[model samples]
Target chain A: MANDTLQPALPTPESPASSVSTPQAGWVPMVLIGIALTFLALILYIPAINVFYQAFHKGIGPFLHNLQEPNFQRAVWMTLTLAAIAVPVNTIFGLCTAWSLANKHFRGRTLLLSIIDLPFAISPVVAGLMIMLLYGRQGWFGNWLLDRDIRIVFGLPAMVLATAFVSMPFVAREVIPVLEEEGTDQEQAAYTLGATPWQTFWRVTVPNIRWGLLYGILLTNARAMGEFGAVAVVSGNIIGKTQSLPLFVEEAYRNYDTEAACSAAVLLALLAIVTLILKEILERRTGGHLRKRH
Target chain B: MTATDHLPRTGTAPWQVFWHSLIHLPWTWRVMLGYLTLMLLLPTAALFTKSLSIGPAEFWRIATSPIALSAYDVTFTTSLIAALIDGVFGVLIAWVLVRYQFPFQKIIDASIDLPFALPTAVAGLTLATVYSENGWIGALLAPFGIKVAFTRLGVGVAMMFISLPFVVRTVQPVLMQMERETEEAAWSLGASSWLTFWRVLLPPLLPAILTGVALGFSRAVGEFGSTVIISSNTPFKDLIAPVLVFQRLEQYDYAGATVIGTVMLLISLLMLLVINFIQAWGRRYG
Candidate 1:
């Protein structure tokens, strides 16, 4: 009723702006857009372009050469392996957490959600420090691990754990709302029709939240592969062994290997872009919960 | 519903409540809790315990050491400046994106999250290169004697870069939800654009902008990858606290690292609470 008292201009999906904000002074919109564009061009677009420009500045031969370096290839493999290990773990955690959240209400549910979101708030450096505290040679489990000859705090185990710590919340954050929206009516119907819980979940619920799951997994994988600070603290940055791509970029740039650094940066930049584009598509496709701050 | 749902709740003892919830718990809940305990809770507990093991005096002395003090000053001051800049320009950008039609608007809108989706290490490398003394933007500022890269100013640039999207994303939703008629009414009553914005728009926008600034400030303060790369890492000059923590760790000062790390984490956690409060206020007032 109060809405009817207002202008009847309904916002369309294509141009929500124009409807809510009626025609302004022509210069107003133009100048606003121009200033925004100019700001983005300087801060965002220029940096993006400079990465590509510097990567190719020395010509494609050197660029290709940099990409072919043993350490560079090794870094790429490390990142993929890290993502493969971390994303699935977080995905399972997210799915189970979301399932528990949607299927029942429990005491301390809100507190649990807050705990899941802890990594998002904590500094990555601090997060790494936490892992070191728990697993470092001088740490709580240090002696036990020493006796067993298991190494952490500077190895693949530590790297995977750090990546997992940093990227764990994405899948849960993405899925919870989607699960809430999809509801349980279909699952209940399937159960009523003699389908087992697993069958109903696999056949009914999984399809319902596939887009959300994909979005979550996409974000988780990107974060897992690109993680830097925490992994840097724990990975020991041993070239060809522990350095992920992001760490490799920093090391290369610091060593004055501009071509190598930028080439590797180009790959990570592409991952970032791919993450962005796929994010856009998923967001549009599902009208997703990405808009909300998780 | 589980069996517990049908149970009478009046005057139930706490232990009984716990036992009821425990025995009837679904497999998913059990798995989820176990994972979280191993992954999130234990690490967090370890951090606090290790930091506290040295006692409060030691924690204080290490946390407030001269270098640590200077690092916090640099981190908070630069982050504040960056967040303030974000608040101003973020409002303008969100306004334009949600209030005006333009070519590539959707793309531009999505670009705001590039800082977020893009890895900070990548962002750090790019910002350092592009703002170096010989680079494009740095060259433009060179004549003004304004150095950006490898300085404290570069730290601010990085903070602003990474936290750029917070204010815009926060404000965009509120701006999109606004009624156009209110602005028209203000304008028809002889208010100028600035006057209307000051009187009508800024009121509702204040909470969101504050929330955004708080969020960005927390993010900037806790930032590691980019600021560590961009700044000179001088103890009293450009070095931020997270970098300082990393420095201490490299020197085998795990205790020093933990103390400083605890301080940084606590500051961010405080900021998180403040942001949530502002968001709650926004919901209430809006």
Candidate 2:
């Protein structure tokens, strides 16, 4: 609220003294900032340090041995397998949606764009519920699928579906803008040169949007691996079976295996760090290109 | 040139006609239609059908149950409080990142995105560990009569953490795009910093800031992963709507879960609509 009061004066530049005299420089603001930042630091640093410290307590031997546990290995594999399946599926879906939106005109274009952005607005936990409502035995489609003897929820398929549903928007959101900005000139040029649609897409369009697509896929991978709410609801947290890395950490923490939980968390954190680094690199490169053009 | 001059006057093949007609469809239209039909329409329809098929009486009974009502209160109030907190700091952080040259700028910038990168469950677990009674920060705060972990405050804190990046990232680009000359002009005119910021700079940034707030609020409302881990799923205390939905599903209360979920979805949709309206109004008048 104090900040809201200060917002109106944002355009003005005053002497340092006068500026400090404003409401934002009051003791209240200082105290608030201190509390906030202190809380932030506590929230960020403690568990992070705890995990790494726990990991390194007996050096790499025990830590490495922790990774050899059947549950840990299964979690790692499941996380990767989910990402592997979901990312590609979502990427293809995103690409097709982007390509369709980019290249054709029919009806309800704006409506469709909003729909493409839907998953971003919806809660992941709710998304999992939707999947269950549709695919669970009591679901509308669930009965139909059951007749075919197909089990979706409470298994790997459910995990994949939930991840893919939430991750679908990433690649499309990234690629659509690039395609919109770049226009269809390159594709048209390729078309005029006697290239087929597939060739033009691969040779011309993909090259132009590869960075965006990769960035999108990278984001998707990070989310898929880190995804908890949707997966947890559907995966049933069946130990090594449906347990993702995040779920493994949660289960371990719940089961009072503090050391194992922290170690698993550290593994997830490491993956997060790597993705963050990659995202930074890609963002910087994209920003540089945009700057050059401007 | 006449149409006849541009093209050979020959009968077109059926396949050629079909392909040309398909290709000639407006790109945006085709993709948009398909996307909406498949992604948005189908899933939402499924959800709604589930919600509505139980009829109004059953829906009301399920939705107004004590547990459901409590979850709603917790979800909305916490989300609102968290969003308000994050909005202020999010703007400050964005401004600092964009305008100030400071030590550890890159680190601070990256740190702002930690919530976005970290898994919500991990974030929740981390927060719980750090704020528990025997935890590092908890050890210090415990003497002060402030218990964080497994409280409403913990829910708010976890929600704030997970939703932080939305507001900051949303506001950052807008802040960066603002021309510096406006501030300089206000200063040259002898306006006080507060006056200039209030009269000139604040109006334009208001829309983006509000958008950020709405996004943060929505995210906090729907946040389940971190909140569940940190808050201990205590109903009527720290229980959020999404967690309630999960609990309902686990208990095989499909209709009840759907009713609660639909309420949340509707509320979020309303908020988003309001935000969009505010953004449009701001663009037109602010």
Candidate 3:
């Protein structure tokens, strides 16, 4: 089962008449690659390198000085806390959701699938607004919340909710396709062998999907940490209190605190870099089969 | 009587069967669906309700007002342009990554997702700096009397930054899995390389390309973080709908914000539906 080759949903028909051809060892392909790389450098690579250069251009003195500031520290702490609370909850939820969707054949399943992806398609600002409509002072449950003296909107909880909403599909999206392809043969065999559902899931299913699950968690953590728009509306951007790192970057940049903004941005970029590295490591270790599934 | 008793049930009541099935469902389904309903379903439902509450006339008025209309025009047009640019360049990059071997090729392949991994605010800040007149690339282009940052072009660039990975990632796998045998066959038949590509290679690739375009379009349309910083956000000039929605929320204009948010939401939903349809069609026919 572990060695089984799962066919992707869209099967490419092989034409027996012809063998696939490789590019000629000549100048044309080289020129094409060069041109493509130039565009990529302009659009993606240069801007990224510029970020690191600018952040450190003033030397480590100001960079270290900015990192030591209270607001910066608070923002980093807030961002980490948000990811801490959000990632685990969503990871567990994603696992359950993927398992159910992959194993069951109920009606409206496609709708459920689309709903999971709704966050990705929806604007983050709108995501914040939806929560406000439900939990804001004049929201649907506003009066009850006020009566209970509970705060959601303009608070940590609200920011976490928005972040969770934005990053919801990551884990499930990663795991679902793999689970679908893996099928239930081993699972059924486990059941026949008198293994309990939980046992089968732990011993059989989890092992198969762990790599995809880890990839999803990494992505979810990154997005949750970096989310700005949704959390911006919901968090009120109260410095030293509610501001996440991304919000700090925006506020700092708008206030013309380029040093602080760039410093904070560099931290986030490092996080992103770390994510990329880990992703690459995972891809290499897993033979990168899961990478293509997406 | 014996036959009747032994025969399988053919006409069970629908609701009764549904109830039985619901009861029989595992705890996993209940937990998953229940959680999704609370966290996702409820919030989305609230937006729909609030949007509808504004009365059709008011919703239409706000949705199509000149400012709203201009924001819509800027948002959709720039997103489309960005998506198209990404479509062409993205395919090129994917082709290179799959078809070539060069120094730092591994690094370049991995770095394609830098935009995805970076915080949008950071990306925005970085791109803004890089494209500003006094900045690196912008300094070179400044002599040409062309400005990138603080213009509609800047908005497009930001959108391009955020959406490029979508195009590349979607198309890369298909390209990797492509059977080169057919192109070889065409060549053996005395067909030119370009002709072989134009006819054989492109037909199968078109659907994936369109899928990538649609996905990139949706992402670019909804983009706000990078765009807000890079573009000047002047009304009817570079102000995008998402930023406008943020501006409204800041002004305590909940109703107005909800209306605009609803508009963005509906349009995005339509796009997503279209994408899903295209993907389904590709699956069936591609």
Candidate 4:
């Protein structure tokens, strides 16, 4: 664990950028790798495996039984609906923001960038508080909403808003860097060739950033599906009505239905695993394309 | 023709020129700002107004109440401890992944982000299960009398889990971008491995490590879902600030909740400023 990177790093006389291709540092790298792996196994891998093992420990009977619960089904539907709404909304905003940021330089540009990143830095719990402050009864717009007979908090609308806020920055964050790297040269060329702004965006810019956009959408979807803290605050954790899968796990555990909780968790864990695998593929794919383009 | 073709040629007012140029951009900045305001800015502004509507004296009292202070203590101390732990192991993990050759490496590299993708509620459940007295790892430590789950230690573990990826991801790129000739130069000059590391490697990497630690600390401080479940939520013991905010909200003490939320918001924003400053410093020096 100590000085793991301090190897006998002798890059073969001017082997351009391939810093010490071979590890001849004997047992050091091996020992370091072992320590790191052991640490990760205890902290991450073992805990992750525990989720699946606990889910099916009572055999497939209870696992399937837990999944068949109506609330569980509702929770799954609610989660997908939230993701379906939040991901596309943010994806479009991400594209628009990326295009605007990439196509021009202006005052407050850094400020705008920072604002896009605000939701990420914010605590999900506080994010809920903000929304509640705005839309809850006795809130700033409480009278207006009450006059209109609207219930925003403790319902699907606020849940969607909270989910959107928490996952909002992902698409923009992922796409901005890619667009900045690609620059506006291609878009300008398309415009000079008499293409409309939308045409230039769809034909030239979108193709160039499709992988990045997909990467962002993948993260946004996974987060929207898995968001617990913010959604918990805003959704009121209503059993069959507002409970997303993550909330269902909490409620099930609270009810001493460990099997149900673990089963629902397994579903989310599967989603996360899928997200991770796709993320890896995108990173590798983007890496290859980025190298070629540059 | 493009939007600029209609611009008045001779006496274009400055404001008119600004508006015309803005409209002619490939994307509409209006919609971008409008969305940004509606989604992020407006809600945040509401929180500020609501929280600050109460006079400063009262706001200060609520934010620094004994219970609130204790929660902040647990939140900050535990998060700092977790982030420091991550700093050590995260660097080691990044080092091994970047410099060493090993099998299943790519999968492990990707898995560092598991905490980001996996729901925290699931993480909390599993951690509680695995660290309970009769649980897998807990059973081994039971005889030693070190309780983990349902304690502050459990909260720290949860924080550590979520914050691990930040440090690794930040430092990994910096480590990869480093020049090897400096280290080779030091080695060729008869510097010991430890000395070469301290003198040649670490100085350049310090800013990145600090930035990662700051980001991780901010993240851990804001963490709610997992810590809420892992900790018993005892007021003066293991409770975190975010959990405290939830408790206040649950009790319908909106004022109490908003005050604490504002304090946490300010601290998290301060952390961000510090991170940005560190990155700028690193860019200039490293």
Q: What does candidate 2 score in Cα RMSD to the true structure?
A: 6.0
lDDT (10s digit) by residue, model 1, range A49-93:
999999998789988998889999999999999999999999999
The CAPRI-style docking tier of model 2 reads: acceptable
> Model 3 clash pairs?
A19-B181, A20-B180, A20-B181, A21-B180
lDDT string for model 3 (B1-286, tens) is 3312433366878676666666766787787777788788898889889888889999899988899999999999999999999999999888878876777988888898988889999999988999999989999999999899999999999999999988899889888888866865666655555778789888888878899999889998988889999999999899999999999989989888999999999899899889888888888875
Superior by TM-score: candidate 1 or candidate 2:
1
Clashes of 2: 14
lDDT value, residue A43 of candidate 3: 88
lDDT of 1: 0.87
Please give the DockQ score of every candidate, comma-separated: 0.50, 0.32, 0.47, 0.51
* Model 4 alpha-carbon miss at residue A136, Å: 0.2
Number of clashing residue pairs, candidate 3: 4
Error of 1 at A47 (Å): 0.6
| TM-score of every candidate | 0.93, 0.87, 0.92, 0.92
Off by over 4 Å in 1: A1-23, A288-294, B1-20
Cα error, residue B145 of model 3, in Å, equals 1.7
Q: Per-residue alpha-carbon lDDT of model 2 for B168-286, expressed as tens digits?
A: 88778777778766875666566665687788778888887888888889888888888998897888888899999999999998888899989888877887787778768767964
Worst 10 residues of 1 chain A by lDDT: A4-13
Docking class of 3: acceptable
Error of 3 at A150 (Å): 0.7
Alpha carbon lDDT of each predicted model: 0.87, 0.79, 0.87, 0.87
Model 2 lDDT tens row, A1-294: 123432335554556644544434435444544554555565565666666776677788878877889999999999999999999878877888788776545466666666677677788888888888878888768878988998889999999988887777888878877888889988889999999988998899999998888888888888899999999988888997889999998898888887788788888888788877887788788873321000
